[model samples]
Target chain A: MSLRLAVLGAGAVGGSVLDLAGDYGHDVVAFADSSSSAVDPAGLDPSAVHDRKEREGVVGDADPEAVFDADYDVLVEATPTTLGDAEPGFSHVERALGDDRHVVLANKGPVAERYADLRALEAESAGTVQFEAAVGGAIPVLSTISDLGAPHVTAARGVLNGTANFILSRMAAEGLDYEHVLAEAQDLGVAEADPTFDVDGIDAALKFVILANVLSDGKTEYALDDAEVEGIRNVPGTALDLAAEDGRTVRLIGEATADGVRVAPRLVPQGSALSVTGTQNIVQLETKHAGQLNISGRGAGGPETATAVLSDVSRLE
Target chain B: MSLRLAVLGAGAVGGSVLDLAGDYGHDVVAFADSSSSAVDPAGLDPSAVHDRKEREGVVGDADPEAVFDADYDVLVEATPTTLGDAEPGFSHVERALGDDRHVVLANKGPVAERYADLRALEAESAGTVQFEAAVGGAIPVLSTISDLGAPHVTAARGVLNGTANFILSRMAAEGLDYEHVLAEAQDLGVAEADPTFDVDGIDAALKFVILANVLSDGKTEYALDDAEVEGIRNVPGTALDLAAEDGRTVRLIGEATADGVRVAPRLVPQGSALSVTGTQNIVQLETKHAGQLNISGRGAGGPETATAVLSDVSRLE
Candidate 1:
């Protein structure tokens, strides 16, 4: 079955979703960004949309607000994350859910910060919310928990942040200090200019909160402040060297248990499943009967996140 | 929604299914073994069934053939795998699918040896077939592909066999030969008495065939003979030691590409995703857009496989 999609935020994720929509049997009916938007009652051609966006500054001539009322089956929110109170992204998701349209989120803020509100909206709305891309990029972590059902999941732990992990991995491998590795990561475009969101563990913590909510199916609501957070910024070079002596590696790990969410730099055995390397993510789910299940992959990338969004769209009945 | 199930096979897999059915919100109304069968339309108590099976040496007093005529929404096939023609398991699956009942397979023979027949049956039948347990037990590998839509999958590679992996991992860690480790694994109840299916690469090849068929959505029929198989029986410890000098590890890998399927021992980088140890299994999917996705878990165990079966049952909408 083909689904009509109104995509907000024409960034890498949203743009790739438009690019790959036809491949997954979905049609893009509308496209929106902060400044410009486009719409068609029928489906918009992905290639044509791409050309238009490239040739012009926007997707089309329509107003940004036009996407809110566009006739579509699913609304994809891929805007930049707004941590506290989750602004424009929050409003975008709320408006979409209010219209009884299924929402597929690539934005992490609204999910991690405003999960309860989204759940409330879903309770009265005809459409459901899917955010597989919100946590682990292409890793299908949330859907795995949902597929197995909530009650069966006992604990979820993983390397949820890519940039932080990249820095830590480089530090351990090259015996470099935190600042030197951070500079290298920044230069390589892996870490952001500020890098506080990632290096301070807030990004991983946010993803952990979202995972916790997903595992509980919204029964357990955890916010950013609820987690016991620690970053890799304080991890010294000597620590990695000392860990290596014991045949271990330092990974910035995010864990969500019944107790709550925790994100910190943890010493992991060198060859274990949790000892994943740079830019790679792993989610280890402890189940009541299924035993420990670990899923790892590219945690973040535009096309990779777009693939996750497309997977969610295809899964919608 | 609760599904009525008639399970065939009274081994660890089938028994664990009955034991864990109540926890997963399903009812086990009927169960069958080679010699005896049981029925409880109102839903049999898992503990009671366990006690009966222990005391009577059978599930119940009914004839084994009675299972074919029993009424149920879904059928769980956990019969032992038979190579080549895939006898009793194939026949059991055909009967269930013919009767318009959803089939959840824990058996490998039917899936590996009879993909084309099963696909035809699914097309003609009202009910669907789910076999997450057939590939990587409790890892949700098959369903992940199915959910992502098979067309997007470019290639799939993994550590599919647990017994072979366990023996190889033991050999590598202790610097012992295959025979010594195999004997230790046998004593530890990790390897089977004969271990032919595992050590000979047939088991891994069968799973690779099934996975290849799944990736093609059964459009491409691949059997055991289709794969270029090589057993780990001849892998010398000297080779592992040589690889370890360069920070590499030896693993028995199964790969399925558009070209064909292959099972053999390969050298993997020590800290790579494919370098999973012991009885763990890892499936790395290379997608057109999702990048490289990896899922790893316990590939064998009565309860782990049973949990996969239970997950399949709950997912049969």
Candidate 2:
């Protein structure tokens, strides 16, 4: 059965989902952005919707609220991350779940900031929520842990923040300082103009929080504040050089264990799985039975994150 | 709901499964070895069963045929790997499937040697087959692909043979020849006394065949003969030195694509995901949408393989 999808946030990631929906045998029936909205109870032509968003800069003139009553089996939330209130994303998720629509989230805010509320919403609603794209982009880290079951997962650790990793890796390789590499990353569009979230460890901490919630199978709750966060902004080039000399590399590692969650720069052996560089993400699940299983891939990109959203839709089926 | 399992092999893998069954909320209702079998419809005590196997050298005095009529929900096939005929393992799986019981395989024979037959058996039976343990011991490689839906996976590549990898890694790190490392691996119990299947790359080929079958969602059939096999038997220490000079490492990689499946020594960069050392296995899936996903972990071990079997049980749920 093909899913009828209503997508919120017609940005790159959400638009990419619309672009690939047809290939995955799904129809995007509704779309909404912060400024504009569109809806088709029957089924909207994905190409037509995509073209409209690309050329005209708006999906349709329909009121954004129309998505609440719009005909869709699943709601794809790809809104930007907002920590405190989880904003329009959280509200969008609430309305979708309240109306009995399955939700596939690429937005990190609703998951990382308000996990407890999200779980409560899911518990009372008929529709389920899936957020594979929220954490490690295209990597199915959440599903892997969930599939293995809560009892089996002992811990989850990885190089979650791509921008930080990119900077650290370059600094290590070229003997350059942090500011130089950060500037280079920004120039290359690898790091955002305001790289606080990426560099300050908030991004990795948020991902670790989400992973912890998944590992607990929603029996427990965690928030950004709960984690002890430490980004790579303070990691020295000398440390990376010394580590490299010892056949190791410094990586911005995020970990979630039974005790707590933390994100910090750590010295990983050069050939270790966690020593992945660039815009790559790796999640290593320490299982009681299975040993350590490491999954690595492109952590973020329009098409890549969209692939995860599409995978979530398939999972809903 | 607890799964009632009948294990067909009282060796380490099977025994480990029995040992850890209770923790996963599973009950080993029956167990059989080459010489003896045991059955308790109510459920066998995991600790007792483990002790009996370790101390008494046999699980029970009943004939092996007793397992055929055993009351169980799933059959755990942990029998030894017999490539050609796939013998007792194949027959055990066949009988279990015929009886409409779910089968979780740790044995590579039934999967690698008789994939087509296995698929046919599954199609005709109400019970499904899961074999995460067959390829990568504790790694959830099969389930990861299956969960993403086979349609998304375009190709799969991996360092599959643990013994070969152990030997190769030791050879590379210690600047020892294959012969020297092989002996050390055997002494460390990492490789078998007569390690023809592993050294000859047949073990890796078998895993590649199984992964290919999975990538195609069992639509395509593959066997041991289908792969162009090459092992790490002839890898010299000099070659490792040469590769290292260029920042590359030689790994016994098994690859399955639309073109063909092959197991051979490939030059993977030192920091590459496939450059896993020792007995670690890494499977990289080339997806049409999700980009490349790399999963690495222990490919084979008694307890680790048992974890995969237990995970398969969870997947059945």
Tell me, by lDDT, which candidate is best: 1
User: Worst 10-residue stretch by lDDT in candidate 1 chain B?
Assistant: B211-220
lDDT tens digits, residue span B1-317, model 1: 88888999989899999888888878889998889989988888888778988998888889987887777999999989898889988898888888999999999998899889888888999988888898988888888887788999988998999998998888878899999999998999888899999999999999889989988876689999899999999999888889889999889999999988999999998878888888999999999988888898889888999988988898886
- Interface quality of candidate 2 as DockQ: 0.74
TM-scores of the candidates are: 0.97, 0.97
**In order, what lDDT does every prediction score?**
0.89, 0.88
Off by over 4 Å in 2: none
Candidate 2's error at A189, in angstroms?
1.4
- List the pairs of residues colliding in candidate 2: B137-B299
**What is chain B's TM-score across the candidates, in the order shown?**
0.97, 0.97
> Could you give me the TM-score of model 2 versus the true structure?
0.97
Model 2 backbone overlap count: 1
Give, for candidate 2 chain B, the lowest lDDT window spanning 10 residues.
B45-54
Tell how far residue A122 is off in model 2, in angstroms: 1.1
User: How good is the docking of model 1, as DockQ?
Assistant: 0.77
lDDT of model 1 at residue A297? 89
Tell me the tens digit of each residue's lDDT in model 1 across A1-317.
99999999888899999888889988999998888888987888877777888888788898999988888999999989888899888888788878889999999998899899988988889998899999989998888887888899999999999999899889989999999999999999999999999999999999999988877776779989899999988999999999999999999999999889999999999878888888988899999987899998899988899999999999996
Residue pairs with backbone overlap in model 1: none
